[model samples]
Target: MTSESQTAGTRVLHLSSAQLARVSRALDGDEAAAAEFDSALSSDPVRLLVEVLSTKSVPAGSGVSYGHTFVTQHPTVLARVAIGYGHGLPRKAGNRAWVTWSAAGGPAVRLPIVGRVAMDEFVVDVGRTPVEPGQLMCVFGDSDEGEVPLGDWAAAIGESPVSVIACLDRRVTRSVVE
Candidate 1:
């Protein structure tokens, strides 16, 4: 009843192997248990939604964002998206990371984050695709839908998968969709 030795699931990090085994046993179940567990952890529900501010056309040689770290190789559309380092987005991801956006009634497309990330915003090269202001841009979410996976976001910041999910600041609005 008191002391017993057991092994735990490898996914749990805080517990010793024996203690983990005990927890694993307690949480373990049969067919129904497996189904429940799979359903619970199958996908991440959180998505960082950055509102699109504006869009414009820049010449092929135009410098993008701050410092001209990225220059458009061709005339393209640049979109400024709200939410940046101040909102828990990693500034290091600037000019390195990318996001997913779809023009009105258009297919989802991957857009590169260009130039330096500012305290309040970042830029994306959307290429001739027309985008409107106030449209929401997905910074990280379901990859099946062409959005950037959480792993990629974590990788951009030199961190693990869980760290990116934990980086959301209070500035990000949360709404329950039922």
Candidate 2:
């Protein structure tokens, strides 16, 4: 009935602070509210970077990853991303999900996670991309250059985004960006 009651109802629905801001935008014509919501919703706080620990050139018929879950159908370039279950990368991600990788100054390439993700690393089919030792791979996060969104990982592994992110091991090196 009253403006105060409407605002109070919106706030009572357990909406996030960002969602509340959007509601306030409609109620009070606060232009800044939209900006705040966008910043909060779209910006991921945790970005993961994995180094390429090694690379193997596999001929067709080669088994990849752990347990031979993936067998190369053709000649392929495989690289090991140096973060694994021990680093908070879920074992369930193996052979089911993908990671974003790029050569220096190159466009991002999507690579499949093959085999069982080990405790310390996982295998990716680089597929002729020129990957080298120490090249960076995005494990998960928001990047201006683009990345595998957390939702995609969730869908791949049948987990919720919160669970996917919350399981990250505390030993991970976290760097904050503005």
Candidate 3:
């Protein structure tokens, strides 16, 4: 049984039939099922980090993204990120979700994902933070600034992580950095 892990990086666990049974028992609220199951599952290591492709400062009440679902309440800086539903970011993440970005000498900022998630692009309201075109953004996963946990995103979309994570498009590059 292979699962994502943080801290020590990735590991592949080949659980035997007996071990699988133990994991099943443990999941069923068994108090003393298997120590391996308890020790194995740790912080999720999967992170979808992408580059900001562009940035623009829009005036107050400006309509954003496709269909104008999000109209800015005030003048704000916006960014176009590289990922979209076509890249495995869910369309449901449109106006309901957010991403984080860290500026060189400044603290991390939470930016709302505005408008509809397109096939290959999405917009984010960066608020007052001055964002650049090449800055990296945390679409999801853990970081020093914080995290966009899978559970939070799942809750926002009324779906499970198992259903959503797999939606990440295969065409998107995936790297294993240890």
The backbone clash count of each candidate, in order, is 3, 0, 1
For candidate 3, what is the total of clashing residue pairs?
1
lDDT of 1 by residue, 49-132 (tens): 677778898888998767889888988889888766766678878777878877666677888889888767789888876677
**Candidate number that wins on lDDT, 1 or 2:** 2
lDDT for model 1, on a 0 to 1 scale? Answer: 0.63
By lDDT, the better pick of 1 and 3 is 3
Q: Distance from true position, residue 14, model 1, in Å? A: 27
User: Candidate 3 residues 70-175, lDDT tens each?
Assistant: 9999889888887777656689888898777777766666778999987777899988777888778777655444757545655676765434544555545555
Which portions of model 3 miss their true places by more than 4 Å?
1-42
For candidate 2, give the lDDT of residue 166: 43
Candidate 2: list runs displaced more than 4 Å.
Answer: 1-41
Model 2, 1-178: lDDT tens digits are 5332112110001224444445357346565654454445345323467778778898999987667988999999889777678656689998899888877677777788899998777899988888888778876555466677656666789875544544565555434334
lDDT of 3: 0.65
